[model samples]
Target: MNGTPIRLRELAPDGGGQLSKAEQIAQLRAQLAELDGGAAQEQIGGEGVVPLGGELANVLPNGGLPRRQVTQVSDTPSLIVEILRQVTEAGGYVGVVGWPELSYAELSAQALRRTVAVPEPGLDAVHAAGVLAEGLDVVVLHARSEIQFTPAQARPLLARVRAGGAAMLCVNVAVPSPALRMSADIARFHGIGRGRGCIAGIDLEVSAHAKGWKRPPALLTLGSATGGVTRLKAVPS
Candidate 1:
């Protein structure tokens, strides 16, 4: 995906149309829970896993994204680090496919567990997701699944994540196209409220068919997954 340009002609029948401003706001709120680091975060099974940082947790669905298969957080490696931290907890076999340097020797070892690091960090994302979907507890989908795949091709991959109950994090160079990335569960990014060097007040937008039929756009301030959670606005769907 480095040289290849991402196209979003399939986002809607007309073209890559933007989500209604109102709808975007609704989705953002739906994905996020509370703001600030002042919140109690309990893993699904009551394990106290050390988080990457306070900033990243607030951006997720439950103050942090869960490992239940195919949960993709669309952002950069900094954001992905926060997600990887959660995946290494108990009941979570973490696999960072297609992000070799960022996943293995480059990451803070304390933040990860027995990671199955993949070479060629950019190209292997989708392939690694396939292998880890059922065998692992969580998979960070750093590949651009939304760009190269048809909905039909992506369905099975997403389904495997669902069936396997694994979490996914997609590291995108650009905003994702809606047509290529739809699923039963989603935690969306609304926009950034305010920020400094690393700390930020980010507005996260989201909607999930499973969490609740009520998928509305809303807002929340997100912190850092590593130390610098570069906040950005949502790409118009």
Candidate 2:
């Protein structure tokens, strides 16, 4: 991802008339397809992958998060922050929507400078994400509880991500379909003190499986104070 921003041109309706939401989505999809030379498949390898850092990189088929695709993060929300941290730390811009609770102070100054945040993303969350995807290396979206999208509502957003060569990190929301899915089977905090002991770290058993991969689960230990993740040795089966 270059430091330069890519701005998406908004399409206007015919005859100066307004377009319905569905129609607008369709138009966006068409524009995106045209931008990619009407071949979405070509975008599969167009942009370089973003490294997840540590052993987590090994979980994905590409050894990193693939641009131009939606990757779902379920069960362990912290993983989302971890990803954003990695991307920003690497000089990649990131945009986050509908996640006001996130602790931005934990992020490094360099990373924070490259990150954009939308505290209250409303009904146009998908639209906002599509716009952000135009330039950012990664866009993290937290679907609002009241927002339920039909297949039609999602297809265009996915297409936009592909065309723009940006990765979408969906939190608690399903895309049309995800190219890769990461789930945590277990997450526990350790180092509890009797009176004033602080949380030492967290232990997670995360599994990564794509459309046709058959890899084993990955064990991770995350330190709360340092924001560091360590891959534990796999136990014998």
Candidate 3:
């Protein structure tokens, strides 16, 4: 014939007309990897863990926060600031939703400069978080007493965080289901005198539990003075 040849469908390895299940899975994985930016995927710190620094790292099972995951923090503002401190110090951008009263003076100038604040509540707050997740490396949503998220509402926001390779910190807000839950209780005050001396520092008994961590709850001592995290230590159960 003088005409160009027609292409035929490729045959399966086992001589079947369709690909094998294993082959299909492999192909899907390859496609997903490509969509994920290829084999040399980027991680927050090459290990996918954002270091919390010093003793704070010792408390978490992975020695740091896992990027692209939700970490719910109880109503401890100082602790939240500590988490943000490490991320910002590493040259990451931070977005705060519905937390307007955050003391800027406690944060480093660079950290303050990198922070994006959205002090609104309700749906607007959630929308703000979703928008920030698109471009920020870390997003903190302060639910306070006004906002609570159901699984349906939280899934899309979390998906955005994962797709953007950002970490999410939910303050005073219960996540639909979180990978990690951290809470703090005031243990004692270090520098406060009866009624004369100014308040100096307070000792916080912090504990963390995660979904896959087999170890008992991680107990830690977090000390804050002058609105700053000054010390961290691992406490034996």
Candidate 4:
């Protein structure tokens, strides 16, 4: 995808000469497969894994997020930001779709520069994500409440992710056979002892479940103390 240009076309039908929504999506996937040049089927070991940082590495089975797979995140905005930031910092391109609430300012300058954002794709969120995954290292898609995809609708999109060797992070959408499932909850706040000072850091209880295996919960700290960065630590069992 280095020399190839990414042009996003409208999903609407253009008079009598236009392709239907389904046809347009099919065309996008076909184009992606051609642009992929069979790279997705090639296995290069570590090169295929996105750097999930040391702390996160400890919890994941692959020691990082694996390319050509879809991972589901349970709508943890901060965690999502951290994941995208890490991917971008590693010189990978990222696409964010349907997350109009996500603030780009929260991302590092480097991440912000490398990210492609599609804040609101209306009902075409899934279609937009598939197209972005064709060329990006990672794509974060926020599932729309009104649009629930059946298994039939997900297969082609997931195929696109695999065909391009890109990871898809689905927020609050349960797709079939996700490689990993992660959820985060705020456990407590630090540096606010007795309510005497502003919150300097936050402790989050994060869990990772891979297929039939479930790892012990991990503790992640995020806030001003760490310069608003995420620091993950495995809590002792």
Candidate 5:
């Protein structure tokens, strides 16, 4: 049900010097909605990650981070690091879903405007989706929250994006809608091994998942922006 209507009389005490039954219900609904983050999630898809459109073109295969759904990455929070950076840099507010799982302060460097951390991570993903739908540029769900699959939950967001009407970005750590898949434009996944005292090398793997992106995912070693990301290797489909 939608949030309970808050009527005028509820704002005051009754003859008994206490809120009436209806008022009590209203207050309860109000609190519940606030706690739930404002809305409910709709269901849509199934598992297996696929790339989305080219938004992060320079960083991933589909040229874009997965939109309207959860994006699962294996290591280093590489996808989140770059995608959120891109989102905030483009002038947007970013929300972190799983607070404990991320080094938020270190990540805040990416936000151009402001970053709002969700106070509680205990809410289910459907509830989380409701809160996200209210208003947010980006919401990153780490491996903390309880997420589920519902068709209506994700479809509207996709519709909003396709219509260019919604200015929100939502991320999940669990599975996503089966109809929804994101292609990487130029995503970089980097791993480096070194002794506790010595610096070895950073291995960077890049992928292009766009339909027009003929280039395969590449793996390279790094040095710096100019000289790093060297030794590109294509990934065979």
Candidate 6:
């Protein structure tokens, strides 16, 4: 709580000393937010929103990712990559914890470099996120299916996220409250030559919901040719 940044090394794995370490990091983030007068929370665009870009933007009530809040995402690798790419391309720093399965091949070189990744945080996933949130714009925590996300564990991390002015993306993790809950599935694949040619693109059915509102499901495409995301036109019903 001395207003000093918590280094990655200071993180303690879950054990007798885990809770105290988590608390320390949380306090540091709170102090940092206070020192900055919550400037990050007061960002101008859409009242501190992080634009996800393209048609995906329209899917959110705020037209983008909510800053200083938590959003739960399904364990869809492509969709997660898209979110990270957009955030980093927009000049936001990102931290990813406990997602060793995520592929960065689609991410731009610059974006990949700007990301701080902890493939395995053991039992300190939340603590690692808090430390990274102190300076990163977004912290993604991939909760292992075996590990439960209890409210006791989530409250402090959620507080750290708000105080640090960073967005938290929980994959396969359930916390008490989240600004948005999102999930996506592959609708179909394009350009397959009877199992002869490689897949060229995929159509994704994305759903986003919030406390008081929900956007109509969206169809998006990730094409190998363009290696980018775009809103796919809905076919006439």
TM agreement with the true structure for every prediction: 0.45, 0.73, 0.71, 0.77, 0.47, 0.77
| Every candidate's lDDT | 0.40, 0.65, 0.62, 0.70, 0.40, 0.70
Worst 10 residues of 6 by lDDT: 1-10
Task: For residues 1-237, write the lDDT of model 6, one tens digit per residue.
Answer: 123231222344567756465565564355434423432343324437777776677778677778788899888888888788887777666778887666777767667655666676655677778776766667788866845568887788888888865778888778877889988999888777775878888888877899887667777788774565455443322
Model 6 alpha-carbon drift over 4 Å, by segment: 1-47, 225-237
- Lowest summed lDDT window (length 10), candidate 2: 1-10
lDDT of model 4 at residue 121?
57
Better of 1 and 5 by TM-score: 5
**What lDDT does candidate 3 reach at residue 102?**
66
The regions of model 3 sitting more than 4 angstroms off are 1-44, 121-123, 214-229
Please report, as a residue range, the 10-residue window in candidate 5 with the lowest summed lDDT. 42-51
- What candidate 2 gets wrong by more than 4 Å, as runs, is 1-46, 146-148, 193-196, 224-237
Model 2 agreement with the true structure over 91-115: per-residue lDDT tens digits: 6767776676666544676676666
The candidate with the higher TM-score, 3 or 6, is: 6
Give per-residue CA lDDT, model 3, range 155-201, as digits (tens).
Answer: 77788777765667888766687878777787776666777765566
Q: Candidate 3: lDDT of 176? A: 80
Cα lDDT for residue 84, model 3?
A: 74
Ranked candidates (TM-score, high to low): 6, 4, 2, 3, 5, 1
State the lDDT of candidate 5 residue by residue for 1-237, as single tens digits.
013221111123335565554544454335434422532221111111122223224335334444444444433454455545545555544455444444433234435233444433332433343444344445555544345546666565345433321223333433443322333333432333353433334445554333444455554443343243234445554
Error of 5 at 81 (Å): 1.9
Clashes of each: 26, 0, 0, 0, 41, 0
Clashing pairs in 3: none
Per-residue lDDT tens digits for candidate 1, residues 187-231, read: 433333456244333344432222432334322234543244434
Report the candidate with higher TM-score, 2 versus 6.
6
